[model samples]
Target: MIINQSIITDIKNIIVQSKEKAIRAVDHQRTLMYWHIGKRIFEEEQEGKERADYGTYLIKLLSEQLQPEFGSGFSPRQLERYRQFYRVFPIASALRTQLSWTQYKLLLSVDNEEQRDFYIAETIKNNWTSRQLERQIYSNLYERLLVSNDKENVLSVAKNEKFPSDAKEIIKDPMYLEFLGLKRETSYYEKDLENAIITHLQEFLLELGNGFSFVARQKRIHIEGDEFFADLVFYNRLLQCFVIIEIKTHKLTHQDIGQLQMYVNYYDRMEKLPHETPTIGILLCADKNDAVVKFTLPENQKQIIASQYKLYLPTEQQLLEEVNKELESFEEK
Candidate 1:
């Protein structure tokens, strides 16, 4: 009798899948246990009307009693977090089974309810790991998108209630590329930056926002024997269009904007199908002047945009100041 190697491989795959499913089931049960513990504690505190005066004492006493019997996981600090978890969620039916306790713990740290809800929906949609969720929150993904777009509309997208109609809706101003491990002061060629982004493509895509898939890098174009190369090309399924990106290591100028406009026109006329929407060109530069961008494009421009890129994450205070400045500018307009 001849032994089949394919059957052996199939058995291995089945076993691995079974183990994975079992692990997920266990994790879901653990998450439910924590939520129930939080619910019970919250109910007890509310019934006794001791949350304001003796809440800390109650948690401490519970920890002292439970730790020796159960484990250190029942510490006072963890119990406090559980209490906060219940306070934030409140409804048992609203808890997501896909999120583990670790993800919920990180989500609990977000003070804004809308932001927390957005992250929750996005984490499930994107299947983000706990580390990815942490990075997104730390990078202020919600605030960055809200800086340029309407708050309600962006949150709606997060909840899957509405889709992005235009490239601008999904694109963020001053994209944070701190994951590339590049220094802002360093002088590097455009190719070097592009290579780094490619090497860390997963992190780059997260920074690029949702529904973007990589298409090409250094895509060649020829028009009447004049050749050009686009730095990066991506297709956003949500927007249903191709995105052409041009990289500049210095402040943007009218000439750069004109070049990007040509790329957009080229893609629209030559590359885009009749059923497809217009291609969008993005100028990712180290800096940009709003006035320059305003003057370079036509008054009714929609397909071309110039945005600044930062190699490092900005401090929360810096981001707050920038958002405030943008709001003030919008009010003046």
Candidate 2:
């Protein structure tokens, strides 16, 4: 029997979509099953166990028996993971089946309940993969978000709900650049840094946080037929706008802000959708003066954001100092 062209096309489309749905359903079911298994194991382990010996022996015996049968996935360490998984995700209903075990494991690392919840909401909202979630957590996404936003505002953003229109509302301070793998005090051309970011684009996107999709690097823009190249260009799904980024190897300067503003304005007028939010500009600088950043633009400026990038992770003391200073400043204001 010969199928009509339209009928064949429709059949193929239906099969493709059905397979996709089936895969997602299977994954969700598997995740829920693991959760249940973990919960049962934890409950059994905790039943009238006031002693450490029973717990230790139980894991050891299970590991020995399960390892030969089930192999590496059932090691003693993995059993501990299952136990901790149940502990961390006590409420099975609250678990996001779309998120993998790796993402949930990362969430368990966050000791703060509120912060963990925020990341979880954002992860689900954005449909981030395990690697993406890990990158955001390592980059201190929650702390940076909390820098200038109040608890309510931050929570709302994390929940993919409405957020106030402010530069600080969207920008992550001291933006993590560990993906670039550049050493401190090293001199590299802007092209080199851009290439590194491109090489590890997924990690870069995670560090950049939600909504960013890379459009191009060294994107050209024209003003009065004079060409200027943007270091990077991205479109933010959340903000529904273009993001023009400029890279600066030196401390952020007034000139850098002006240049970025020009690009932002150009994008707004030339490329932005009429209903889209204003184009957002970011200056990724090696260093920044917080006071200078405050005074460089209009007090109510919402389109442009300047942030410092660190090649290596900040020391705990440095992080503490920055956090304390920001908290103090907030208190003063």
Candidate 3:
């Protein structure tokens, strides 16, 4: 029997599409299974309100009984995780199937309800992978947003209380590139770091937070006779604008701000769609002096922002220092 070539190609496409959907279905079912298991465990452990001691003992006993049969995923620590998971995602029906266990795990670690909800919405909106979700949460995307935008604006964005017309809504103060594993002490060229980020672009985008779609690497632009290249170009669907990122391997400077401003202007004037909002510029640098940045930029500067980057995660003491500093600033305000 002779098979028609066109029919054969169509059959192959159908098979491929079917397989993809089947895999997604399997993943969804598996996630639901885990959630239901967590729910069961949580309900069984809840003796009464204000019964932490009793709950702890119950988890220990439950783990001991379940561990041998269920293996490592059912250990005492994991049981506690399950309980916390249930608490974080109380409504099983509302839990997104697209999100993996790792994403859920990362989300459960976050204590801020508004921030958590923001991430959840962004995750679903962006279809972020688990690794991506972990990186954003680790980078303290919410805190970065708070520092970058007005307090009222930031909180409103987090709660989805209001939507902005521009990319400014989601632009963070500091774009964390810790996943690149670059040394803090060793000096490197901006291009070198930019190349590395390009190589690990997926991880970098995830760290950059939600709604970021890579548009170009070393995106070129010509002004009069001079040539300039943006370190990275991305489109944020949530914010609805082109994001021009200028990567600096060294300390941020006024020149960096000037370059980014020029790029933002070019995109806004020459490239932006009639319906699209203005382009947002970000200067991602190794180190930043907040006072210097404040003085360097014009007062009432709305578009350009300089953010400090860190290679490693902050320690508990560092986090405490940040909190205390923010509190002090709040008091002064």
Candidate 4:
């Protein structure tokens, strides 16, 4: 009396899917409950009481009573969070079925409305996990993109309106590779950094931004009997071009720029299809002289991108504490 292997597999899949759906359903309900709680608290606070005093009083009293029946999720701090969640999102546009209670909580930690909205948009577009969303916020991803790219493109990303038509919109200056597990004190060679990137390729892709697929590493190309090895090669679907990266563990020089430019030329001339745009060359180095980079590249240079890499990343707890500090400062004011 044994079950068929395929039947067992099918049953296992059903159980797994059901569990996932049940979890999603529970999360959705919890998020809705929080939203409703927030709304009621806001309405009650607005009636005849001063916001600073009455709001705090209402949440504290509510938490004390609800804690005995419902456990610690109804703590005073949690109630205040719910109130803040409502205050930020409001009745018009707060509830998104796709986002869980935890994700919404992360969004609520964000102080700026536009930045919050942008995070929401990106989170939804990329289907980012709660952890990924947290990382993006702390990393100042929106701020970084806003630097080189235009405001409209940045704001309109969630609207699905022509995000990153060019390479510059997605590329970051001083790319953070703290996920590579490289130590700051240890001296590393270019190959070591490249190896780290290859090892943490998934996180590297996230740092690289959307629509990039790894093509090759140490791609060998021969030009008139001289052979050159491109450090890393990637294809960006958004920009429709090959992105060639050369890692330098030291300050960028004009000669390094020239070498990267040559690699770009080879890719554009030999590798890329006619329909694709010109190859984009990037030199990811530790430090660089902007004046040198400016003088080295052409005035109309859109293909060549040079970015510095940082080895440290802020922890989630640190970012959460920063948010708390900001909130405390605002309260003090």
Candidate 5:
């Protein structure tokens, strides 16, 4: 008897599909169980009518009995998390079936309700894994976007209720590039930084916010007898435009903005399709004076942006300071 390769391939695919289905079913059941546990704890605490005085003790006692019988997952810390989860999502129907217990546990750590909602919506929309969700939260993605956009737009975009219509809507200032493993103290050329971004393109795209897809590196364009190269090119699906990025290792200048403007013009005229929106240009530099950028572009400018890039993540306090500074600048304008 001869064994057919096609038969073996079909059998393997069926087994793989079955395994995936089984895993998803188990995960869904586990999430449901945790939610139920959280609901029970909340109800029991409320029934006692002295939850404030005895809630902690009740959780500890429950953990002591449950951990010994069921395993370590029912520890006091986890029970507290479950309680908070129930509080956060009082209605079980609001719980996302796709998310796992670990994902919900991570979401519970976010204190701000609006910010937490944004992360929850984005996590589901992007199909982010637990690790990805954790990384985004730690990098302060919600705060970073809030710095650039009003809270309403930020939440709307995260929820997929509104798409980014302009470059400013999606671009984060002082984009964190710590994932590239570049040291802040080291002196590196623009090429070195560009190389690092290309090496970690996936992470770079993640940091660039949603809808960005890499198009080219050092894309060349011939004009007259001279040739010019764009450092990086990406297309944003939501905005329906080409995003040209020029990396500068030092502070941004009027000249840098002007050069990027030229690149934007080139893309708009030469590369962009008739149906596409105007091309957007970004000057990603180590530092940028908002005043300089404001003065350099025309008052009606909408396509070009200058943003600083940080090799390391800033502390929450630092991020708050930056947001306040941005708000002050906007007020002055």
Candidate 6:
């Protein structure tokens, strides 16, 4: 009997897709079930509010009963987490089916509503996994952004409430490169850092900003007397511009800014389409003095930006101080 191999392939694909959908459906239903449990427990606790230790008692008793019937999935700690989830997202409509319970648990850990909302928006927008959400939260991406930009604007851009008008709205200062797996003690050349970024390109893009697509690395440029190679070339679709990055392993100098500005000019003059915006240049350095960056660029500078790169994630106290210093630096201008 003649049998078509294509049919077998099609059937296998169909089965795989169906199973995937079924798994997602089951996960979503489980999330809803958890929300329902939380809501019901909260209602009961509210009803017994006048009683001493009523909320605690209600949760403990419910956990005890649920554990035997449903097994340890309903442990007191888990039940408490579920309750907290419902509390955070009281409006049932606010629950996103796309997010799994694990992602929701991460969101529940975020105390600030604005920060939580930003994470939710980013997670859904970026289709981030629970692990990605955890990394952003632990790295203090929200607070780091707030250091340079207004909270409402940051959230607005993240939520797609408004399109970003300025590069500052999207680009981060002191972008974290810890994911590149470079040690703090180790000194690296520009070529080494560029290679590391290329190897970890996905994570680097995520850290860079929105809508970044890598164009090239070590992209050669021609000039009358000299040739130059841009460390990284990227296109930002949202901004509709070319972004040229130059890596500096040391603190930025005026000459570095000048070099980046030259790259920006060349890209804008030669490479950019007339309909596209001007090319934006970024000097990614290990350390930078804002004063040097400020004075080195033109007064109406919008295209060239000097950003610092950190090898390691900052501790809570260190993050606080960095944010404060950045805020003060901004205010000074």
Write model 4 residue lDDT over 4-103, tens digit each, in one string.
8999899999999999889988998888788788889878988848556887788889998999999999999998888888888886355777788899
Candidate 6 whole-model C-alpha lDDT, 0 to 1: 0.89
Clashing pairs in 4: none
lDDT per residue (tens digit) for residues 105-182 in model 6 = 888889999999999899999988888888899888888788768999999999999888778788888798999999
Indicate whether candidate 4 or candidate 5 has the larger TM-score: 5
The total of clashing pairs for model 3 equals 0
What are the runs in model 4 whose C-alpha is more than 4 Å off? Answer: 1-15, 48-52, 92-94, 314-333
lDDT of 3 by residue, 139-232 (tens): 6766766653566676666556787654545655556667788886788888888888888888777776656799998888998998888888
Question: What order do you get sorting by lDDT, best first?
Answer: 6, 5, 1, 4, 2, 3
lDDT of 2 by residue, 1-333 (tens): 786899889999999999987877777776676677678778777883887687777877888998998788778887877777787778888877677766777887898888888888988887887877777776677777788888789888788678546657767887878767788778987788888888989878777776789999999877787999999999887778888889888888888898898899888888988899898999888888878877988897888888888887676578768877887888798
Residue 326 in candidate 2, Cα distance off native in Å = 3.3
RMSD of model 5, in Å?
A: 2.0
Query: Could you tell me every candidate's TM-score relative to the true structure?
Result: 0.94, 0.81, 0.78, 0.88, 0.94, 0.94
Candidate 6: segments with Cα more than 4 A from true spot: 1-16
Candidate 1 lDDT over residue span 35-86, tens digit each: 7888888888878684476777788999999999999889999888888888
For candidate 6, give the lDDT of residue 256: 93
Clash pairs (backbone) in predicted model 6:
none
- Decide which is better by TM-score, 3 or 5: 5
- Highest lDDT: give the candidate number: 6
Candidate 5's TM-score reads 0.94
lDDT of each: 0.87, 0.81, 0.76, 0.84, 0.88, 0.89
